[model samples]
Target: MQSRRKLRFRLIVSFALFGFGLSALFAFAALNIRTRVEDQLVNASLMDDAKWANQQAREHPGAPSGSRLLTGTVLSDRTLYKAPLTWQSLENGVHDIFEPGPDGEEHHYKLAVYREGGIISFLQYDVSREELGKQQLLFSVIGAVFLFGLLSLAIGLWLSRKVLKPVSELANRLRDFRKAGKAEPLAPHFADDEVGELAHALDEYSARLTAMVERDREFNSDVSHELRTPLAVIASTTELLQGSPDLTEKLSERLKRIERASRQATELIEALLLLSRAERRGPTRGETTEVGKVAADVIESQRPQMRGKPLSIELAVNAPVSVNAPASVLSVALTNLIGNAIKYTLEGSVRVEVGDGRIEVIDTGPGIKPEDAERLFQRGVRGEGAGGSGAGLGLAIVRRLCELYGWDVSMRPRTDANGAIASIRFS
Candidate 1:
């Protein structure tokens, strides 16, 4: 497609070429008219001189007649009659007999003679009206071209803008429709040409995409619902086995590990379901939830999991902070960050800091490498030196929930002598 600048340039060039051709034609006609006028002037002058000379010679026989004397004197001037008369000269003069005579190309003359007591004289002069007419014609053509070109250009630009306005509006509407996860309908302007046809096709495509997304969402929801009952039964049976007294130490340890793994799988499945919900719609409707309270609750719930670890957990919540967000989503995200911090730091401490609309989880574990930091929150991607047996969905879930709630998440090396810090900023 041609850009606006290129289209304007093409139109200007076309108009200029057309104007130049017209100007050239006018100039040619003007030159032809001038040539014809010069020839007629020359012929008439010669005829008048001949008649005057003959009348003078018939009236006066001895002394030279006034007309004869005048003609002879004029022709004798070498500067005035530069070229001698020849066949070539006569033919050239006759061709333009109705056109402006040439000045430098050929010299014109007046001649007089007496024959049978009759004085005959011939006179010639060049006409220059053709050159003046050419000038006038050129000026008129130029003025007309400028006036018409400007008017046409103005009208063309106006029409182009009017015609393209509908397309521009439709583009903006389609962008909004996509962002809202809705189907875009054909724009009203799509009632005519190829652009209109394209708009209709886009509307059809968007409808299909919306339907496919809806189906995928329903499928994810159904699967999540079906798995909940089985997972709940398994969790309950594992708890029962752990409480029994007949188990040997080795068997008990193995069963405990299985129970932990099963619990982790259940948590991961729940996170996946939440993510699917967030993707299909958006963040859950927000309520005024106390951030500090949520943080304290998550810490208390996960305390048992850190019992034998050679690490300390610290909570440094300053002022009471509140935010409008889903309480469960925020709690889940904070729990994952704190868990990772505890799992990674072997012999140091993990700190959870809560402030105005913000939470930071810092751990004294081996700090993340620069390359690893970039992909830390990506699903199924574990950083080097991360704890073994981690599902790697913790940070991924945190990142997705933050997006759904319009929060910001960032990670950096902690300044305090040990690990990495993950920060979440709520808007």
Candidate 2:
């Protein structure tokens, strides 16, 4: 998975790492170069001292060792055999030697050997002081690396705060906009920079979004107002026709269906308008809807969907429940659940249960696939066995309505039969 840490955190980390790495590389290079130069100079000096000591021994036959030499006298056949075994094989060049001292600590030194015929000269120079100096330099370099890293971290903190200020201000303003339910231009509060450009873009997008929303609300209001007129006329006409003096029984039944459909359409329009406006169907104005009644009405309205499929519709009210919502909202939400249950079931039964602070529609039909259970509630998504000219928006509208009213809706496959159960839990 990718990291979700803020950009400022990443920037700070990058700065710290860069500073640490550069400082460490420079310190390492400096230490290496210094060690190489010091080693070269020490080796050359030791070699020159040895050669001069050899010349002096041959000229004066005996001479105190040069100041750089560890041995004052050159060993001959008698004394050479008694010298340290490591010094016996003398070559005409410089060499480095290491051996354990009497204290079990290793000794470090440079060896310069001069050999001529039966005479051999040995010169040694201890490098313990140089080793001590290199150790001190190593410690200093390590300290400097750490010091630079800390400085980088401090600088990162300050720079991140300064750099992210505009972005942070933008976020704050956006948050305030949400709380106030309004959008204001952010570019005015910022300087001409990348953040300012982002603010300008956001402003343009918000304006477009606000205009689109306004257009939608106006269109929905206009459509709903226009449609209410026809639905009223149909309802009044159906009532008048039902009172006809010679109305036949079959004709009367058909008229009653027409009346029910008109009423349903009117209620659905009110509910959908509330959804489009994103207005809560609150009970502030004496509106408390009974769950069982809405479920029954929705079931009756959806019966024509059966199409002589021999399907049974059932309503079970195990408990009395009421909600602080408009009856039309409940009607629309229940209509979707009950309608879906009826649509998918060719035969068998669709049962609606309203109680326990919620409602559920259980249907005996081709059960939903486990994977498609959640997707079924999404817009433009339908079950595999869906058979209709539906655009697959019923469940999506239902879900949006439920969210507006602080309710939850879900569907699950039934374990006992080839069916699905849809639920709405009111909160």
Candidate 3:
């Protein structure tokens, strides 16, 4: 997936860029106009100085004494020359040049040439001050651009916060609702705007969802209560039938099966109810239970399912182990694993090995697909090798039970054979 920029950051960057672009454009235009105006003014002044010096030469026919104008003349007769030796190669128009002045400082000058009455006059106007002024103006414009750019950034930040405050609040409220189960109503906290509408919608959706969850809990509780009564009656009746006098072996075996099925059904209901309650109220306290007893009960309860198949079930209790967890939860988790092993195995044995803090159900079933490893425990996701008789919820319930008790459950293929091993480790 591609990473995305946040809305607030994008907005602030856009405004800042806009500000910089406008400031740069204005600076460029201002500097260009000022340069053009200064060049024209300097050229006009040089032209006027050159023309007046030419008139002075025409009237006097010699050097104009005591004149402060930095002017020189070269007569065509070569009889009355007053121009510098460097002006001998001068052109007939204005030229801007840099030369050393009397004070030894490099100076910019506009040299203008005017010819009239067989005499050429050269006027040099020192424009170094004006050049420095123009530079100062350029610097001022650059400084203004930089200064206003910073101001624009500050303003952009302010505007972004002002505009995005409502959005931020809405986001905080959504996060708070997830963590704390309630948030202030957004519409009442903000103005009637688009963000307000989004907040209002979220608030309504949260309310509806909360109510729906409450209804679901109530329904599960009611169903569990309603189902337990008949299950208890069935269990008592099955026990009574098993104890009847003159009961045949065949009838006694069938009654035992019925009793096991009833108990399994009752335990299934209880597991589901406990799972639902745990989701709503968090995990309840656990009690110390004999792990071996739970494992044996689950294995015995699942034995009837293997009757018609060429498969065997074995229990390998290596050590006397115990765990701190709900006995029903442990039974359900083990039952799901053992049941799946028996249900899927075409032949061979389903082995339950009890070890320290763990139980491993190794089966000779077709090994699970490596591609389905991550998804096998998810609800409604059946591996390709899973038989079609189940809703794919057994492992999902097992996963939930493990989560509630902080246990670890894992399944992987057995590399030595065409089988899989499911392990549940208690923390």
Q: What are the models' TM-scores? A: 0.58, 0.91, 0.80
Candidate 1, after superposition: displacement of residue 43 in Å? 20
lDDT scores in order: 0.66, 0.86, 0.81
Using TM-score as the measure, the top candidate is: 2
Q: Per-residue CA lDDT of candidate 1, range 266-332, in tens?
A: 6556657768766423334644778788787777666666778787888888776777665666777
What clash pairs does model 2 have?
Answer: none
Shift of residue 305 alpha carbon in model 2, Å: 3.3
What range of 10 consecutive residues in model 2 has the weakest lDDT sum?
64-73
Off by over 4 Å in 1: 1-142, 161-193, 235-271, 279-309, 369-375, 378-381, 387-393
Q: Who is ahead in lDDT, 1 or 3? A: 3
Question: What is the C-alpha lDDT profile of model 3 across 1-427, one tens digit per residue?
Answer: 9889988788888888888889989999988898888789767776777777777677776666222356444355375355666666776778877889989999978888767776776767788887788889888888888888888888889998999988998887778767986655667887788987887897798778779989989999999999999999999999988888999999998998899888888878888997887842222464477778888988888888888789988899898777766677788888888888888897999999998878899999888877676689999977566466778888999999898878899899899999999999888
What local lDDT score does residue 20 receive in model 2, on the 0 to 100 scale? 97
Q: Candidate 1's C-alpha lDDT? A: 0.66
Instruction: TM-score winner between 2 and 3, please give it.
Output: 2
Which residue segments of model 2 deviate by more than 4 Å?
Answer: 1-3, 59-73, 76-79, 99-106
Error of 3 at 89 (Å): 7.6
